[model samples]
Target chain A: MYLAKIYVTYKPSILDPKGETVKDALHRLDYQAVSDVVMGKYFEIKIANDNESDVRKMVEAFSQQLLINVNMEVFRYELIALSTAV
Target chain B: MYLAKIYVTYKPSILDPKGETVKDALHRLDYQAVSDVVMGKYFEIKIANDNESDVRKMVEAFSQQLLINVNMEVFRYELIALSTAV
Candidate 1:
């Protein structure tokens, strides 16, 4: 089995209202030291496969499919073995 | 200055269409090993302060305000110093 960790994020240039709101809140919360806040998503997926090449193919396909919005978001991932018994 | 890293994620019960789409894409891409994909957001905030207590207060307020939906999303954060010259 393998573990795939994916990090999803909004394009830097895009305006993230969620992030803006958090930054504003920080400022008001007396943390005027905080100037910015941006938010993104992270996912950890488990797969039952042993082939590294196959897993990469899987993650690449996953990214292209449902994992990301090419228009607004970008994604990156890392795959690790579940059994570090080695 | 400090760095606030906020990780935002969709509640498990919530349906992430983006994640679904990525999963579907992975299947079609011949990575059938991939069964699911869930996406979320990550925000990194840079604060201009050295007071740890003040920074925590700021992040807590930010999370309550614009950092998290409190309804649809959840967030967690950590603060690290920018200058480790010590």
Candidate 2:
């Protein structure tokens, strides 16, 4: 098995309301050093396959088709080989 | 300035309905190799401070008090020193 750690985030050009709200909240709480906050999504996927190439292709396809909206967000992932005990 | 990349995820013990839904969708889409999907939140925070310790303390507090729910979710973050241009 392999574990895929994926990060999906809005394109830098897009406005992130959640992030803006959080930033305002931080400022209200006196975290004056905080300048900006951008919010996104993360995923941990456990793949049942052992082939690295196959797993990568599958994960990439999944991200493009289901996990992210390519028009608004971008994604990246890292794969980790899992121990048999898992 | 520094960039804090934060990841907030549900504890393994908690049920993740969104992740489960994604997993089911993947299976339906014929990505049978996908065994599980765990969803989480990602944050990119830009801080105006240069002091590493102070930034770390602030980010930690932000995660605990605002970014994550202690009972259901846990968070981790990495601090990166940014270029003056950003």
Reference-based TM-score, model 1: 0.67
Give the B-chain TM-score of model 1: 0.83
Writing each residue's lDDT as its tens digit, candidate 1 over A30-67 gives 66766766666678676778878888887776666666
**Local accuracy of candidate 2 as per-residue lDDT tens digits, B13-65:** 99999999999999999988888899999999999999999999999987899
Model 1: CA > 4 A from native: A8-31, A39-41, A51-80, A83-86, B84-86
Cα misplacement distance, residue A86 of candidate 2 (Å)? 9.3
Tens-place lDDT per residue, model 2, A1-86, is 99999999888898889999999999999998899999999999999999999999999998999999999999999999997673
RMSD of 2: 1.7
- C-alpha displacement of A30 in model 1, angstroms? 5.8
- What is candidate 2's DockQ? 0.89
Q: Is the docking of candidate 2 incorrect, acceptable, medium or high quality?
A: high
The TM-score of the first chain in every model comes to: 0.86, 0.94
Per TM-score, the best of the predicted structures is 2
Q: Which ten residues in a row have the lowest lDDT in candidate 2 chain A?
A: A77-86
Model 2: residues with Cα > 4 Å off, grouped in runs: none
- lDDT for model 1 comes to 0.74
